[model samples]
Target: MDILLFLIIIFIASILQTSTGFGFSILATPFLLLLFEPMEAIQINLLLSLVISAVLIKKLLKDVDTGILKRFVMGSVIGLPIGMMTFLFIDLNLLKLGISVIILVLTLLLVMRFRMKQYKKRDFVVGGLSGSLTTSIGMPGPPILLYFSGTDTKKEILRSTTLAYYLFIYSISLVVQLIFAGTSKTVWVSSGIALPLVLIGLYVGQKLFVRINQTTFRIFTYIILLFTGLYLLLESL
Candidate 1:
């Protein structure tokens, strides 16, 4: 039964990651915690998310906003170590509760059609938040997703740029996790087992991406954010 759940989670999260460029970590890490130790779940999420980003990034290069991507990378460099420290010393449950509240509030604002203008500095801030989240909880999508959604970014640009940024964040976060938190064979082995599913998702998700209209895409994003926030809130409590 655990095996089945693992496969189901990997398959669904992979598809979501592939289609949306931001769902795998948000959807997978929390569920994986139910099956593995916290560090193990986080490591596995980082590894799998890295794979998805690496695979999709090349094709989406044209859509990437290089200027924003550069700023994100710069900001993430600062955030990565901070996140590692949090993972080492902070109480994860408390961290989850805080993150859940933030996600919920931002998601609600987006739902109300709140808009924000994109600025250079805000790009760095979003990147820093995403980077910190990555190492701390193996979930980096929330801040970036919410920010982009608030700015009313085009789906193609949002998906492509975030995936590009993820390629950097996930790689650094994985190394940070291994060094600071340690890992077990279970993390690597499970990640290997899920690789095939991720590939399958990559294929199917690309197909679905072309079919989803902008309105449907925003609706889907809202649902995912709300679900993630609520789930974390409940789990933390």
Candidate 2:
């Protein structure tokens, strides 16, 4: 039963991640916590998410916004250490509860068509938030996704650039996590087991991406954000 659940979770999360470029950690980490220790679950999420990003990045290079990607990387350097500190010292349940509320509120605002103008400074801010979230919860997608949605970014650019940024964030977070929080063999072994599922998801997701129109893509994003927020809220409580 446990193996079945693990497979199901990895398969579905990989599809979401591959299709959206931002769902693996958001969808997987919380559930992985049910099956492993928090650190193990988080490390597994970071490792697999890094794999997905690495695999898809080369193909999406044309769509990347180099300026924005640079700023995100710069800001994340600062936020990564802060996140590691939080992971080391804070109570995770409280952090989850807070983040859940924030995600829920922001998602609602986004659904209401709240939009923001994108600026260079805001890019750095979003990156910082994403980086902090990455190490603390093994989820970095929320801030970036919400920010891009607010700015009404094109799907191709959003998908490509975020995946590019994730390639950096996930790698750094995994290293930070291992150094500060430590790791177990189960984290690596489980990630290795899920590799094939991730590959399958990569193929299917690329196919689905080409078929999804902008309106439908936005709807899918909203649904994912809302679901993530609700799930975390319930789990934290």
Candidate 3:
């Protein structure tokens, strides 16, 4: 039953990620935590996310915005350590609640037609925010999603660039978690079993991406953001 449940979650999350480039970790981690220990769940999430990005990188390479990705990486380098510090000292429950609220409110505003003008520097800022969130809360998609959605970035570019960024971030995160937090054998074994499911999900997600238009994509993004926010809020409370 546990394996079946894991397969189902990963399949849905994989489709979301392969299509939109940002939902795998955000949507999978919470449910994974319910079934596995925190360390193991997080390790599994990071590993699978890395695989998703790796699998799609070659295909999406053409759509990637290199300038934005570079800026985001530079800023993430600065934010990663700070996020680790925050993880060590901050009240985690409160942090979760705060992040959840911010995500929910920002997503709502964007849904209501709020716009943020795209500036060169905003990429760095968003990247930094994403990096911090990645380490602190194990979810990095909301910042990038919110930024792109607000700026009305095209679906193709948004999907590709975010996946490119995830390729880098998830790899680094996997290394850091392995070195500092450690993982169980179960995490590896489970991830291995789930690899086929991930691939299936990716294939389906790619198909959906081809068929989805901008408006539909935005609506999907909004729904994911809302779901992530509510999930975190409930967990924290």
Which candidate number maximizes TM-score? 1
Q: Write the residue-wise lDDT of candidate 3 on 1-237 in tens digits.
A: 299999999999999999888889889988998999767887899899999999899998999999999998988888776666676688878988998999999999998999999887999999999888777667878899999999999999999999999989888877777776777889999999999999999999999999999999999999999999999899899
lDDT of 2: 0.90
Q: Write the per-residue lDDT of candidate 2 for residues 7-79, one digit (tens) a residue.
A: 8899998888888778788888878989988889999899989999999999999999999999999988988
TM-score list, all predictions = 0.98, 0.97, 0.96
Residue 27, model 3: Cα distance from true site in angstroms: 1.0
| lDDT agreement with native, every candidate | 0.91, 0.90, 0.89
lDDT of 1 by residue, 24-128 (tens): 998998899999998999999999989999999999999999998999999899889888889889997898899899999999999999999999999999889
Instruction: Write the number of the candidate with greater lDDT, choosing between 1 and 2.
Output: 1
In candidate 2, position 105 carries an lDDT of: 98
Worst 10 residues of 2 by lDDT: 17-26
* Full ranking by lDDT: 1, 2, 3
**Which stretches of model 2 miss by more than 4 angstroms?**
none
Task: Summing lDDT over every window of 10 consecutive residues in candidate 1, give the lowest-scoring window.
Answer: 1-10
